[model samples]
Target: MPLSEQEQRLLDEMERHLLHNDADVVSAPSGDRTLSYRNLVYGALLLLAGVGALVAGVILGDVWGIVVGVIGFAAMLAGVMFAVTPVRRATPVTPREATSAKRQDSASFMDRMNDRWDRRQDGR
Candidate 1:
């Protein structure tokens, strides 16, 4: 069955609201840290080397092979950790500044959402 006019209108409004809010979420700051391209590249290189070592170890087989494989595994683990870990900002964000900044950003957003909810509940 097709949606009634009121239902369609509500759906449209919901879509608009979702799109607007989604833009905010997408653009929101990720905090005082970021990933480095240099780190990523180095990590990838390390990971590749680890894989090669692992394969070489497998082919060699024996006590030494086991040691090489373990080392390779550790290298791979380190590479992954290095790649994903975010670097801290040079200047640290003060707790008060962080809280105030976050509150200022989110307060308006929450208020808007609350107003919308109120309007919606009131059948406006």
Candidate 2:
């Protein structure tokens, strides 16, 4: 079933309010830290290596095996930690850069939305 006219109007009002109030959120700058592809690759390799060590440990079946198994578990845990940790960006985003980037990316999108809304209102 379709929304009633009143429901549609209310929805439109809510959208307008959200767009107005949440423009900052929509255009928010990514902070100083981000995940590195290099780190992800390295972490994955470490994790695989850890798994191999763990399997070998199981096969050995002795005190040495226990030691290797513990080491492997530690490596796997470290790999996961390393993979998820975000690194600091080399160059910090200046205020000017942030503003310009945000405007360039989001202005056209916001303009398009506003234009569509205007057209919808005019049609009504």
Candidate 3:
């Protein structure tokens, strides 16, 4: 059955309240995890170049080549990391989830203090 008018109104009010209170959470990026194909290809090419440079440096025992190889390796790492990194993760957050967590933390803290007070009162 559909929600009653009062229920609907309550829900709408709750939504507005949640949005107002947790506007930052709602606007925060949720990590879109799509990879850019172009970037991935470029990353792969860079990795390959780095590997080749490192191998050539090791085989020839050239210090400058080794330095260049390390730089290439760094570039490859950057490219690969950029390609793999998520733009944003899609997170569907509700006010209840946020508040519930906070409430739980606060409740735990209060419970601990209350328990201590009770123990002291009971002299045990």
Report per-prediction Cα RMSD to one decimal.
Answer: 9.7, 10.0, 12.7
Query: Per-residue CA lDDT of candidate 2, range 1-124, in tens?
Result: 9999977865765565554558676434358877889999999888998998899899888999999998998889888888878888898755564455444545555676689899999995
| Better by lDDT, candidate 3 or 2 | 2
Give the per-residue lDDT digits (tens) of candidate 3, residues 1-124. 9999977865655565555568676555343444557767877787777777777767766788778778777876876786675453355446566665554455545576589799999999
- Pairs clashing in candidate 1? none
Q: What TM-scores do the predictions have? A: 0.51, 0.53, 0.40
lDDT of 3 at 113: 58
Error of 2 at 3 (Å): 38
Residue 97 error, candidate 3, Å:
22
TM-score: the better of candidates 1 and 3: 1
Between the candidate structures 1 and 2, which one is better when assessed by lDDT? 2
Worst ten-residue run, lDDT, model 1?
A: 20-29
Best lDDT goes to which candidate? Answer: 2
Off by over 4 Å in 1: 1-29, 90-124
TM-score of 1: 0.51
Cα error, residue 112 of model 3, in Å, equals 55
Error of 1 at 80 (Å): 0.6
Q: Give each model's whole-structure lDDT.
A: 0.74, 0.76, 0.66
